[model samples]
Target: MEIRKATEKDVREITTIYNEGIEDRIATLETEVKTDKYVMEWLFQREKRYLVIVMEENSHIVGWASINPYSHRCAYRGVGELSIYIKREYRGKGLGQNLLLALEKNGQQNEFYKFVLFTFSFNDLGQGLYRKMGYRKVGVFEKQGIRDGEHVDVMIMEKLLG
Candidate 1:
């Protein structure tokens, strides 16, 4: 598989991969499916620091990773929020790790000093991936959200980069 920077043409497949993560209800709180136009706008607007990396094999997009604004304030410009998702069928293949490592390297090149992400308490796989990458759990927002009438906690994780 090849890991590379995503272009406008890749938005649709990236959206598909992200929607799959949303549908699974394990990776994100966003339930609405995204459109290519929206993702395209995001890519253009944040292209300088934000990234969309895709893992491709045989011309099929198998996974993606992204970095977004952690905060809008100027003082927080050096920090970014990250997310990585792989196609459901590709989950066990370490694609997420490859995508994340690429993002980290890209982030450092872009002058980012820190990366942050949050995962649901029940998402052990995601948490383990973050831990293996040297991310530390800084805090937990207890009962921070409710989905399907069930309360869930969110773990906040961070990794420092020089």
Candidate 2:
């Protein structure tokens, strides 16, 4: 597999993978499937520090990762929010690790001092991956968001970067 910066051409696959995450109801709080146009703006219509990357194997995108602004306030400029999505069939095969490592490297290059992410409280697999990657579990937000008509708890994880 090859990991590289994401370009416009990869948006379709990226959107698909993200939709899979939504459909699975495991990774994000978003419930609606996204369109390519929406994904394009999201992936490209951001500052240089906010970056998106993709992993490809056999010329197909299997996963993606990105670093987003944690807050618009200047005080939080050094903090980046993390997002990672792997195709359903590709989950748990070490793909997220590769993407995350790349994102962390990119984050450091772009002046990010730390990275934070929120995941479903019941997402054991995702929590395991984050913990294995050196991210510490901070705490859980009760009833953070609604998923499938029920309030769900969300866990916050973070890692300080060099």
Candidate 3:
């Protein structure tokens, strides 16, 4: 597998992978499935302004990772909110780790000083991956999200780049 920057043309595959995360209901609180229109717009904008990486194996997109703006304030300029998603069939294969490591490396090279993320407390796999990646739990938002009528805690983590 190879990890590389994503292009606008990748929106379709990216959207598919993202919607999979949505359907899983464990990675994100976003319930509305993304359409091509919305995904295209986001891809275009982030393409110029953020670190978006994709992992390909045998010429097919199997996973992706990105660093999104954490805030608009000047004080938060060096902070990025991290996100990662691997196709369902690709999970637990270490592809997600590779994508995230690539994304984080590129972010640091681009001057990002820190990475931050929020994961549903029940998402054990995600939390484990983040822990393995050297992220530290900074705080928690109790009952921050309700999915299927259950209150889900959100664990917030951060990793300062070297």
Candidate 4:
């Protein structure tokens, strides 16, 4: 497998993997599936400090990760919010770990000092991957988001690149 920076051409696969995560209802709070145009706009609108990466095998993108602005405030410029998604068939095969590593590396190169992510409290697999990657649990937000007509707790995790 090869891990590298993501480009516009990879949007289709990225969208597929992201939709899979949304459909699984474990990786993200977003319920609506993303369209290619939406994803493209999201990708191109990011500042230079924000980075997106993808993991591919045999010419197919299996997973993707991105670092986004944690906040618009200047004081939080060094902090980045994290997003990661692996195709359902690729989950638990260590692809997420590799993707995150690449994302962190690129983040650091772009001057990011810390990375934070939010995951559903019951997402044991995702939590395990984050913990194994040296991210620490900050805390849980009770009823943070609504998924499937029910409120679900969200856990925040962070890692300092320094």
Candidate 5:
């Protein structure tokens, strides 16, 4: 697999992958699927502030990772909110780990001081991956959301970078 910076041409596939995450209801709080045009616009708007990368194998996108601003406030400029999504068929086999490592490398290179993210408390695999990646679980928001008619807690994790 090859990991590289994302370009406009990647928006469609990226949107598809992200929609998969939404459909799963375990990866994100977003419930609506994204459109290609919508994602393209988002990419353009965040091009300067975010680092987005995709993993391709045999010319097909299997996973993606991104570092977005934690907040618009200047005081949080060095903090980034992270996200990672892997296609369902390629969910395991270490792709998520690689994406996280790549994002960390890019984050530090870009002078980001830290990265943070939220994962559903019941997503054991995701939680384990974050822990294994050296991200500390800082807090939890109990019953922060409702998914599939059930209340879900969200775990907040952070990793300090140079």
Candidate 6:
């Protein structure tokens, strides 16, 4: 398996992997399946300093991670929000860890001082992975939002790069 920077050509496969996460209902609150065109447009507007990486095996994308703006204010310029998703079949194989490590290193190199992410409270696997990766649970937002007609709590995790 090879982990490399993602390009426009990889957006379709990335969208597939992301949609899998969306369908699982455990990874994200988003219910609508994303389209390649929509993903491509988002990718195009990504902050130039941040990084987007993909894990590929046999020329097929199996996972992806990205660091995006945490906020628009210049005071928050050193912070970024992280997102990672691996194809369901590829979970528990350290792919998420590897992808996150890459994103963290790349983000730090690009002057980001912090990386933050949110996970559903019930997603033990994801929380465990983030903890293993050195991310600390900053807080939990109770009844953060409603998804699929159920209220869900979200755990906020953060890692300082300094």
Q: How far is candidate 4 from the true structure (C-alpha RMSD, Å)?
A: 0.9
lDDT of each residue in 1-162, candidate 6, tens digit only: 899999999999999999999898988889999999999988888768867899999999999999988999999999999999999899988899989988888887899999999999999998999999889999999999888999999999999986
Error of 6 at 23 (Å): 0.7
Q: Rate residue 120 of model 2 by lDDT.
A: 92
Candidate 5 per-residue C-alpha lDDT over 1-162 given as tens digits, one digit per residue, 9 for 90 to 100: 999988998988999999999998879988889999998887788846588899999988899999998899989988999999999999867899999999988888877899999998888888889899899999999999888878889999999985
- Report how far off residue 12 is in candidate 6 (Å): 1.2
Q: Ten residues in a row with the worst lDDT in model 6? A: 43-52
TM-score for all models, in order of appearance: 0.94, 0.98, 0.95, 0.96, 0.95, 0.97
Best by TM-score: 2
The positional error of residue 1 in candidate 6, measured at the CA in angstroms, is 1.4
- Colliding pairs, model 3: none
Query: For this target, which candidate reaches the highest lDDT against the unseen true structure?
Result: 2
* lDDT (CA) per prediction: 0.89, 0.94, 0.87, 0.89, 0.90, 0.91
List, residue by residue over 1-162, the lDDT tens digit for candidate 4.
Answer: 998888999999998999998898888878889999998998888886788888989999998898988899999998999998889898888888888888888888888899999998888999999999999999999998799999999999999996
Better of 1 and 2 by TM-score: 2
Which candidate do you rate higher for lDDT, 1 or 2?
A: 2
Q: How close is candidate 3 to the true structure, as a TM-score?
A: 0.95
Number of the candidate with higher lDDT, 1 or 4: 4
RMSD of 3: 1.2
After superposition, the stretches of candidate 2 with alpha carbons farther than 4 Å from their true spots are none
| Error of model 4, residue 108, in angstroms | 1.5
Which runs in model 6 stand beyond 4 Å of their true positions? Answer: none
> Model 5: runs farther than 4 Å from truth?
none
Error of 1 at 137 (Å): 0.7
